[model samples]
Target: MHDFSHCQIVLGSSSPQRKLLLESLFPEANVRIVPPDNPDELEFTGSKNLFAIMRQLSQIARTKSENVTSQLLDPTATYVLTADTVIFVPDDFDTYLVLGKPPEEDRDGVVRAWFLDHYLGKTHHAMTAICLRVPGGTVHEAFVKTAVSMEVASEEMVDWYLSTGEPAGKAGGYAIQGLGSIFVSSIQGSLSNVVGLPLRETRELFERVVQNGDS
Candidate 1:
């Protein structure tokens, strides 16, 4: 557990990966995972309008952060963090088909096979919307983007990876931090963004919020 003696930060995500990233980055800070309040129907559009998408994501992140603040936080909490992740491709694609974590890991084999046949030789954008609510009750946010390329994975190879169950419950049907890294031909931006959270930008936003906070 991280030390919460001084300040508090609540992470608005139930994802294990996001929580892990927070723990790794703020070893001496307090952290808690809060589920997203947005409905499943809420869509995240990213990397196209860049600015527009980021603005919208910041809004959503702010909304989610405020939800956490109003629902599950203490009066002393110094910060509340929320994030949203999205994947973009050239053509119309399935989000669950790409990024949704499976209900049953047994489907990982099928998912890997499907991904191997389709995602090879393609580059896609991974966008993360990170929001931080400060002690003064204001929201600070940022959008992080990363381009990821998948190699030509064979069906047998996909099946092998699927058997390992790494694709289950992972966004874009793969885990960049785990065995899924093998299929990545290249990553043009923040590698951690593809994994889940973008620590660099998130931290910068936090610093800005703290520095410019209402006095």
Candidate 2:
């Protein structure tokens, strides 16, 4: 395991999953939470093209990092990390649709429709963009995509899952690490990516930033 005992991580998202993951990844480091000033500023609505979606995710993460870093009184003493995740489903026209967190208004209706129309018995990509700003203002950014396949869920199953209220703030209207795990039949990439942050990729990014900073 890479040692981060001497570093401090300033998380720029309010996501509980991300916070837990970061703590697990850097157990010895002091992790601080500093959510973006304007959470809504991370909202992205644009093209469905896979490449375009990837670019947008990266941009969103970078913007989030900038927003949070600006609030830090001593950024040079800590690493600022920000990330964004989304679900992308391919459409009939060879394009993709980006699915973000379910809207608060009629969240149940929205999640129910997502399960019936897009997720159950289908495969979708969970993409997470990570932006890590190391000391000295150097920033490293990357995105990871994981293909998640869901089992065919019956109406009753969907209703039961919805009752758990676990999909409200999650992308694609599901949380793979929670009760929603019962619906995931298989996954093709980083499981952490589906949860929110890609552990291996994120670790590598942090290491690269630190190495470059040292050299």
Error of 2 at 186 (Å): 0.4
lDDT score, candidate 1: 0.70
TM-score of decoy 1: 0.78
For all candidates in order, the CA lDDT equals 0.70, 0.86
Worst 10 residues of 1 by lDDT: 93-102
Candidate 1 vs. truth: CA RMSD?
4.6
Residue lDDT tens for model 2, 78-162: 8899998989887768788888888899998988988888888999899999998887788888989999989997999999998
lDDT of 2 at 125: 91
lDDT of 1 by residue, 1-215 (tens): 32335557778788888898888777534886667665553444343455555666667677777677777646344577888776655544333222444447457655654475457778877888887777667666677889888887677877778778677777667788999888889889998898889977876676666566541
TM-score of each: 0.78, 0.94
